[model samples]
Target: MKDNAPVFDALDLDRHAFFFDFDGTLAEFTDDPADVALDARLGLDLMRLLRRTGGAVAILTGRHRAEILSHIDPAIPVAGLHGAEFPGEVLAHDPARRAQFSPLLPGLSALVAAFPGTLLEEKDAGFALHWRRAPQHEQAMIAAAERALTELGPDWVIQHGKFVAELRQSGGDKGSALRRFMAEPPFAGRLPVAFGDDLNDMPMLAAARELGGLAVAMGERDLPADHRLSGPRALAEWLERGLA
Candidate 1:
């Protein structure tokens, strides 16, 4: 993590809403996703601070709500499944997208099974094949996934991340989730601040910036962020400052 001050002012805290990406932004990344954990005391402090400031906070993550919920305090609002699902809101996207792509899964499964080293993760609307444990074939698997996605057509979008490649419905992303949140109560009419790390978080960072808010990029790997911090500890420290 870098120790540079982000170009943000304390005055912007008034009536602000905060949205955060889970994995890298809120917790340290782990080889096994299940190993990620939150700092319970810090999380409580931040949540309390946001509530006291008349601001709302939410988590926008690529993981399933259940997976994310297991890592963070349950009280926070969450948009999960990469915006495919929201808290208490039925998914607006068509479930049939998965069905349409079902035919391709067999081939994908066969390919992965033969690889012997990759880990296959199946979601309701997408699939992610992780090659973190099998560095030798990471690039090959990514290329295969890309080709499969291209052959599968525009309905499917292939997203690449650290040691993983995912195929999901093209329309659902963190930007969509943030936009949807901004349109609703508790989140609307407030400064929109988002913190994230990774290429997948680029849209949310852009959205926050476009909305006249601050976008803080977390971790060492860079994309585009209004402010860049080294890791979650720095983020927690920044939040403790209250923009004041």
Candidate 2:
């Protein structure tokens, strides 16, 4: 196990730009993603601080932009579909090259349907079959998705999350999204910091730390984070004080 430094001090907040993962970083994980709720006061406070400091804040998630927006204010910048779509910005990478990947979706749907206990979730740019409820079939579901996606060739990418397998249009990931944001105006001069707590978030965590900024991991399972918080409440408390 890697030893993470202490939670960031409030004084360090002024110099950093915060990038967060919504699902497990800001809200507790639930069996159904739809049931996760945002801390309204926390969201409002963070937004206000970002505006006041002229620091940029964005969400980099596997979820579609619209889905993320539905749960929070749409005004917040979001990199969705793992950077396949960033509103107002020309896609840093093209999705057309990955069109052939769609044909595999039906097969994926069929596989999930036959699995009996898995939940097939379709997103704007990709599909995910979650097996959190069907732990017994988790390995089989992943193996099936891997085999199917592997057959699709190198252009398609498979992202594995907590009990979920995602097949998305390729050419970018959370790392690319973070880099793209760093090249833009508001986020350009600021130091990039990110928060997340899942396998999918590893790239963003690495990206932030690579740029000499903070990467915070939430929850009990330690991966890599410059700082660690117990869970969403601890994260919120840290942010509230940091932004204060």
For model 2 the TM-score comes to: 0.86
Best by lDDT: 1
Instruction: List clashing residue pairs in candidate 1.
Output: 1-230, 10-243
- Give the clash total for candidate 2: 0
Compose the digit string of candidate 1's lDDT tens values, residues 1-244. 5566464456354577888998878887776676788877558766775666464788998888988877667778789878888988765555577667677788888887888678777887778888877788887799878877887788788877778888887887898899888888778888788888887888888888888888888887777777788887877777667533
Estimate TM-scores for all models. 0.87, 0.86
Candidate number of the best TM-score? 1
Residue 118, candidate 2: Cα error in Å is 0.8
**Model 1 C-alpha lDDT versus the unseen true structure:** 0.79
Judged by whole-model lDDT over C-alpha atoms, candidate 2 comes out at 0.77
TM-score of 1: 0.87
